[model samples]
Target: MSRHILPPKAGHPDVICAAVGWDRPLQTYYAQVCFRTDDEPDEGEALIWRGTEPGELPTPEAAIAVITPYAEIPPRLAEQLLADMTATIGEKDGRHQAEVKRRLFGSIH
Candidate 1:
């Protein structure tokens, strides 16, 4: 199962995001972001931001970072969480970047 990280708070996280994949040839990372509330559990996990148009991040942290400021979590908490999540996810999979790409993009090769 895909790992999902929630904010270090009660109930559900105010924000959710993930590194979907990487376009190695383009040196770009693909990700998605969303906002969640008690009434909108489905809305929060949906893709509010996606890396398709350009000027997006090439790393999961960066992708998550882009949304941190807007998230309900405190800035410091959000940053720490983003860093921890990035590292944890990376460490969990040796080829985290490639695996993310493959999982999200689907057989880019």
Candidate 2:
């Protein structure tokens, strides 16, 4: 799971975007997106999309298509969110790989 805080915009003051991918069999993944606003603390999360496959959430167009049913998101901001998700996934995957390597080969000096 990874989260990125969207800066306060003209109308929306507090928005947060999060993406989480679960590993599936055969090296596939299921990804989901969540949106939250600080103003509505008790409203709970707004689920943007739950992808059937791993590839759906990485691109802006695909993500926008998925999120459109729930909430309206600007193209530019959607693109930015996609970029952040990509970076976050990369970081998480890298860390997991390193951990696996360390466990198998012992600590590398």
Name the candidate that leads on TM-score. 2
Q: Tell me which residue pairs clash in candidate 1.
A: 21-100, 21-101, 22-101, 35-44
Per-candidate local distance difference test = 0.46, 0.42
Model 1 misplaced stretches (Cα beyond 4 Å): 1-13, 16-27, 37-47, 59-61, 70-109
Backbone clash count, each prediction separately = 4, 0
> TM-score for model 2?
0.36
Residues 1-109, model 1: lDDT tens digits: 1223334233335654333444333344444555665667765655455556333654556655554454333445435434543543433333665576577766323
Model 2 lDDT per residue over 43-72, tens place: 436555454433434454554454343344
Query: What number of backbone clashes does candidate 1 have, counting pairs of residues 3 or more apart or in separate chains?
Result: 4
User: Residue 85's C-alpha lDDT in candidate 2?
Assistant: 52
Pairs in steric clash, model 2: none
